[model samples]
Target: MAPRSSRGKSIRQRGARPPQPRAVSAQDLGKLQGLAGLSLRKLEALRARMRIRQFSRHSTIYKEGDESDDAVYIVLSGIARLVCLNRKGKRNLLEVLGPGDVIEIPSLLPDIHHKLTCETFTDCQIGLISPTALVEGIVGIPFREFNEALNLTVGRWWTLLERHSNFLSQTVREKIMLALLDLGRKFGRRDEHAMIVDLGLSGQDLADLVESSRPKVSECLKSLVAEGVVKREHRRFIIDSVRIQTSLRS
Candidate 1:
């Protein structure tokens, strides 16, 4: 017989219980719903198989026309922008995506190359599910869940189209107001007086998004500053919500 060790004797004396598995909570399920419309059972299944990733500000998550072999990503935290570059190297901002937005789905279509590049606007957490695995998981999900995802994707695309249309039709002042309203809705931090846009975007970037010239954007910003509708501190723009709305009607 093998000699008994002191460690084995100590374990026997303690009579240790087996480790208990963690139970999933309702809050966890609700949080997962925003990420990918995942149900509790589906989320638990994905936790075992999917990989999570992080990206820093200005990091390129995927380049335009890259091969789409890996996985689809869902934004878990922070903001990202999908952009397309023109022949003149001007970036047209397609959309600014926040938490719960999906990325790289356009690549999944047969013979379709990625049309836009995705870049992180801040430090971000993303969840990735392999294309093959995602398809497998979808088979297990109810039809309603799949339809909900499809509808959400379609709605986002429609909104992007509308934004592009508005950019073409709106005047510079109107564009600035709309942009501020959008930024306020998505990334603003509320203060006593107004909602402030925390992102530090360059004038050129603002122009590109608004489909205007950089000089015009500068002039418009200065005019707004003079009117007390907006203020610039360092590189960020702060909008006085009440003043901006009043200025829009004038």
Candidate 2:
């Protein structure tokens, strides 16, 4: 047998264990947009009941129809994809969410389950809020304000759905262009030359987002390259906003 390493022997002698993750704190709850500007007492009360969890990239957070009558999940960092699986087993991408976005709406209501499956698009940190805390007025925020915020999130999803439904009557290239524009608004960063979209999505994923085939999406991307509306940079896309808008208008 090979000789045992001195460091391994020392660690064994000390009976050491790997470090544990830090506990979720009141400040962490404040990071959630809905919870921001909350009174200190309310924040502390809610924080006491909150749980923090980390999910690896591509891992399923929850699936459609899964029971979620317990707590609400808020993303603290990284991106997540909400998708639906049809009877034919084809997956449609519903929305992509980043930090401070709530993962689901149905999860907040009583006796309801998740309507869409949520999966981490990147390694994510999430906070879980107890439904009882909110319902019992422990947080002390106005119910109407909370409900309005929730409704606004749902409204955005509905708008996206309606837009994509209308895309059925449009050309595949137009659909791809519009999808990129929307994605750029959500996840793009401004540079000296153009907006850079770094969502780390694959061609198949983009196809699912726009309700198109991978081959068609690829061809449309080539067309876009020809038009100088967008250029590929590794996994990201560099977009010329003015050109895209002009092309869309014409």
- TM per candidate comes to 0.54, 0.59
lDDT of model 1, residue 204: 70
The alpha-carbon RMSD values of the candidates against the true structure, listed in the order shown, are 16.3, 10.6
Candidate 2's error at 44, in angstroms? 4.8
Q: Pick the candidate with the highest lDDT.
A: 2
Q: Where does candidate 1 have its weakest 10-residue lDDT segment? A: 6-15
- Candidate 1 segments exceeding 4 Å error: 1-33, 67-70, 87-89, 138-182, 189-218, 224-250
Instruction: Give Cα-based local distance difference scores for all models.
Output: 0.62, 0.65
* lDDT, candidate 1, at 234: 73
